[model samples]
Target chain A: MKRNGITIGLIILLIGTAVTAAGIGAMHISPQQVIAILLKQINIHIPVTYDEGMANVLWQIRLPRVIAAILIGSGLAVAGAAMQGLFRNPMADPTLIGISFGASFFAVLTIVVLSSLPFMNGALIPKYYLLNVTTFAGACFTSFVVFRLSKTGGRSLITTLLLSGLAINALCRALTDLVTYVANDEQLRSATYWTMGSLGGVTWSSVWALLPFILVPIILLPRLAKSLNVFALGEQEAAYLGVKVKRLKAVIVVLTTLLVGASVAIAGVIGFVGLIVPHMLRSITGSDHRSLLPNCALLGATLLTMADVVSRTIIAPAELPIGIVTAVIGTPIFVVLLVKQKKQLRLMS
Target chain B: MIITAQNISYSVGQKPILHNLSFAMHPGEVTVVLGPNGAGKSTLLRILSGEQAPSSGTILLNDKSIQTFSLTQLARCRAVLSQQYMLNLPFCCEEIVMMGRYPHFNNHPAAIDRDIVQQCMQEMQVAQFTGRLYQTLSGGEQQRVQMARVLAQLREANAGDVTGKLLLLDEPTASLDCLHQQACLQKARDLAQHGYTVAVILHDLNLAAQFADKIILLKNGQLVKEGSMREVLQPDCIADAYEMEVEVWQHPDYNFPVLVPAEHKVRSILKTSNKNNIHEYNSRSFVKG
Candidate 1:
């Protein structure tokens, strides 16, 4: 009963927080006006004209950014949660498998090299499509390489996986730098901003493009909650409980790659959403993936939306990257969590 | 019903771990696999649990090939507890134990699942810790919780008909203290008595002697001896397997074998008066013979 109450409370809190965040951006729309604007846009007979400037701000500028933040945040957070479960390490994040570095490297390659290709420069091909495809392909390839290199006799050792991730991340970063060094000024600046991460480039088209990769995994991953619970016990125990440990690991890795790859392609390499959101929710939800996954998703959405709101308003007209705002906000909270966890451990001892 | 392994062989890297190992476990009896460290106890358990495939030969479950069964079907027949389990996230005790309902919860757990989990916790004396974080528990308490988790798995597997439930415990008591160790072994014995097939890998010969209805002794990954506890736990066989000198005597109260190191007993006796020491030593030697 208490657990049910907490779940319900968290849901309410998340909805309330998202709504408030959506209302409080730089234009300073009232909550009533925000609701009125939404209702009018939805064809409800409201007194509001959906004020042209506010409508464009809400729908074109803020709404897509909000949705992108929510999707990318939830994707990264749940990916981190599942990765932590799969690797059985608290510190494990989606990037532990090198997906982010791979995505960055490929995104740089596309922006610097592929866009310049003579045939590709033709009017026939869309720029974003080519970039997204290349980035996703590269991310998948690097993750697969990391996965294969970490396997020993058909089983993955956690230590080997961590080391392999570090190695692959370094290699990908080096290649990415090499690409950046040779690029022209404009390409270098774009590559640099992409690495730092922003939702400023998010469009309705980008959201639509990422929908399948992002939503499919989100919908499917929760189905594996029970299996992930069993997995938390250790691989041998999970297998004995009739879990196909190797198969489950493979599916999780692939799905995580998909989610992270999509997020990176859309928002660039947003750092702390994946690492911080899951850890925060784990403390509240008590680590059953059934509960943890959903809560992490909602909390992640709420957090990123709020971060986007701050990034947009904190400096008035000049916007800071959403990624910088998230890190600035997330680091202190992360340190607090770490210290609290240590204290909790001491108390338990 | 009988589960048989025929000429099973496994290797890790270049070194052979299990070589032509063969054994059978029968229902209505506790079959304990006894061996020292690196004797392939865990490897054998993994094979038996269907977690790992043996390099050669086959395991027949009730005269049917184990490979023929789906993972869920195999899970319905057997549950395993291994020595180490770590969670990157802290799980509440009830949540951790409730995971055992995974195989049975094709969709989601019902009230029956909660009841079974609660019952298992009660049985394992872990009910008090149900709301506590699993990581917060002491080593022994954690082991008991794991035992509860397995018991919940067994309960879920046997929810409808209660047949073919095999509990495979690999070094379940290694990290447990004396009280919890006895509790674990007794629980295994009780489960077997209630008609489940129980196979346990035990490191302590005395615990094996106390609870094992039958013992299979392995050395260098091969079955060295197999029989009733009395037949397999003989001092000579144990010494050969462990490379240690030991004496086994019947317990004064239970009549089960009690093992004592020969050197320690000798040291205690030699500290006594010189005159009576010879007499005591001779009498001890007589007892050994």
Candidate 2:
């Protein structure tokens, strides 16, 4: 009952933030006007004195960005939660596991290689969708390679997994840099903007694209909640308790890859949203993935919406990248938690 | 139902850990695997539970190859408790115990499932810690919780109907107190009496002598003795397996074997080697001494 209440509270909070975020951007529309305009879209026009330009900016510019933030935030957070549970480590995130870097490397490659290819000029395909597919494949391939590298005598060790992630992250970064040298001016700008991460330039089309990635995982991951809880007991024990260990690992690896890859393709490589949101919710939810996953989706949506509001308004006119704002906010929380953990260890010892 | 292993062996690189081990666990008996350190007791348990495959051999469950059984199918038939239990996440104690019901996740645990979790936690003396974080429990308390988890798994497997089932425990009583140790082994015996097959790896010969219907002695990855009480309780084979001289005698009150180290007993198994019956000589000499 208490768990349900907390989740409900998070959902309310996310909705409240969404409304406030949409209202506060370039044109300072009131919350009442925001709701009035939103209702007008569905043919329930409320009689209110609102400027046409205010309504247009609210609908076109801010609403898509708000929806994009919710999806990106929710996707990154749930992916982080699942990865941490699968790895049986509190600090594990998709970024730490090299999924994000692999996506970044592949995204950069698509941008550079497509620019030189003559077919890209002919517009045979929507180039953005092609980039998304390539990123997804690259992230999945990275996971496969890392899994193979860490297997010793047919058993995959989580101890070796961390070192493998570090090595792969470094290798992918170097390769991305080496390929960046071959790009022309226009392609270089696209690659640079993508690697830096943003939710700007969003449209209703991007929100449509983000839906399958976020909703599929949101629906699928919670079904594994019980299995993931069993996993907390240790892999061998989990298998003994009827969790098909191999299949569980594969599903988690692929799901997280899809989520991180899609988020990267849509909003570039946003850091710290995955790390910060899930860890904060884990303490409150007590690590049961049933409660943990849903709460992560709500709170991750709320947090990044609030962060987007801050990033766009802090310096006014010239907006900071959403990635920079998240790190600036997340680093202090991480440091404080670390110090508290150290103190607890000292007391325990 | 029967769990039968034939010519099972395991090796790490070139070093052999278990060799040509074969055994059939029977219903209505507690079969305790007794051995010293590095005797492949846990390895054998792992193989029997279908967690680890043997390097070269076959294990059959009810006349079917174990390799053919899916993990969920194998979980529906057997439950295991290993030595090490580690979880970095801070799950509550009840949640930890409830994890044993994973195989039934899709079916949605009913009231009976909730009742089993509570009952097992109470039996293991961990009911008060249900709200406490599992990581905060002491080692012994955590061991009891894990035992409850193992029991919950077995109870869930038998929820459909009680039949001959397999229970493999690796030192389940290692970190337990005297009260819990007796309680745990007694529970194993109670289940065994109800046609559940029980296998345990025990360090205490006295406990095995007290509860086990049959005992298997292992030494250096090889079976030294496998039989009923009288066949394997001989002090000679135990001394060879454990590499320490010991004396065994029937308890004066209960008539079951009572073990005392040679260094602790006077003229213990030393002057009585030539006796016609060691039990008879020991009873006379021990009582007289």
Candidate 3:
């Protein structure tokens, strides 16, 4: 019952934060105006403009960016939560499975090499398509490699995964650097910025395209919360409790890859959200995944949306990258968690 | 109900672990498996828990083949606590115990599930640790918490049918001190008395003798002897299984077997004698005796 109350409060906070974020851009719209605009678009009676400038700002620009933040945040956070559970390591992030390296490598390649191709130079391929396709492919490939390398004697070990992620990440980074060395000045700048991550370029089409990839896992993975809680007990206990260990790992890995891969494809490489959000939620929720996961998803969305709002408003007219805002906010929060955990450990001892 | 394994064989790579092993665990009995470290005690528990398949064997649980039962159905019948469980998580004691309800909680845990967890915690004397983090507890406390978790699993199974409760514990008391060890074994014995089939892998022969109704002694992955505690826990059999000289004596007050190293008395005498010659003779006698 308390959990229900918390969930309801979080929902209200998320809605309020998202609406405020949508209103605080260069347009200087009010919160009421933002709601009226949304309601009128949905066919509810409201006094709001469907004017081209306002419509473009609300629907084409701010709306997609807000939705992108929510989706990417929720996706990364859920992926992080699942990865932590899968690895049974609190420090594990979404990239522990090699998704970030994969996405960054592909994004760099598209920016440096593929975009320089004659047919892909300017006219034919949409900039978003080029970025999304390359990033998705890169993420998929690296995930496959990492997953395969971690399996030894037909079983996966947590150590193997950590080591493999390190090896694959290094390899991807090296390759990306190799591409960067030969790239033109324009390509280098774009590649560097893309690697840092941004939600500014998000469009309605990109949001729609990435929806299923993120939404399916968001819907399916939470149902496995009970199993994951059992899994956190250790592999043998999970198997003894009737969980199919290999199958569960596979499902979680594939789903994490899909969600994170699509998230990276749309929003570039947003780091730390996945790692920090879930860890924060686990402390409050008390390690029950059923509660922890949904809470992480909501909190992640809230954090990212708030981060996006800050990214837009902090510098006013000139936007900060969403990734920078997350890092700036997430680092201190992570340190606080570590210190709190240490203090709690001392108390327990 | 009886769990029967026919010619069960297990191998890791090319080396055999359990060679044509056969055993039956009957309901309402405390069955203790005694062995040295590499004698496949944990492997046998794993096989019985369905965590691993025997290389060649058919295991029957109450006339139904083990493979025929769905994973959930098998889990409903059995709960296994392995020798080593290190979770990289700082789960609270109650949450860790609640994991035992996973098989039974296809949806959210019902009122009955929570009650069983609470009852098990009370029985194992871990109720006070419910809100404490599991890793922060002492080794003995952690073992008791794990026992509570296993008891919760058994109770959950019992809720559906009292007859299907089977508890498999591997070295459940290894981390425990003498007092808690006795409590854990007594709990297992109590579960057996309630008509549940309880199989425990124990290194302490004395504890096994005190708790087990039937004891199976294993040597080199083979069943060397199986019978009632008195029949199987002879000094010779235990010495052979452990590859160490041991003296088994009947406890005057408890009517259970107690084991002491055969050389303990001799070693004590040599320490007090202050004579090198006597010490050498006693060392020789200790091995030869």
Which candidate number maximizes DockQ? 2
Model 2: lDDT to the true structure:
0.83
Clashing pairs in 1: none
DockQ of 1: 0.65
| Candidate 2 positional error at A269, Å | 1.9
The deviation in Å at residue A24 for candidate 3 is 1.4
TM-score attained by model 1 = 0.90
Choose 1 or 2, whichever is better by TM-score.
2
Q: List all candidate RMSDs to the true structure.
A: 4.2, 2.7, 5.1
- Expressed between 0 and 1, the share of native interface contacts present in candidate 1 is 0.81
lDDT of 2 by residue, B1-289 (tens): 6878899999988999998988887888899999999999999999989899999888888878889988888787789998978677779999888877666657467777788999999988889997898878877888899989888877844454658478999998898889889999999998888778899999999888888888889998999998996678777778879987666776466757777777666555565565356555556534534
* Superior by lDDT: candidate 2 or candidate 3: 2
Candidate-wise lDDT, in order = 0.80, 0.83, 0.80
Q: What tier of docking accuracy does candidate 1 attain?
A: medium
Q: Across residues B1-289, which tens digit of lDDT does each residue of candidate 1 receive?
A: 4789999999977899999977888878999999888899889988887778998889988888889989988876688887877665788999888878778777678889999999999999999997899888887888889889888887843345657778899889988989889988999998887778899998888899899999988888988898999888765787789887566666344657677676677456444445444334423422332
Off by over 4 Å in 3: A46-52, A110-134, A147-164, A184-189, A336-349, B156-160, B266-289
Put down candidate 1 lDDT per residue, A195-296, tens digits, no spaces.
778887787777777778788989989988888888888777787778888799888988888888888887777777777888877777678888788777
**lDDT value, residue A44 of candidate 1:** 80
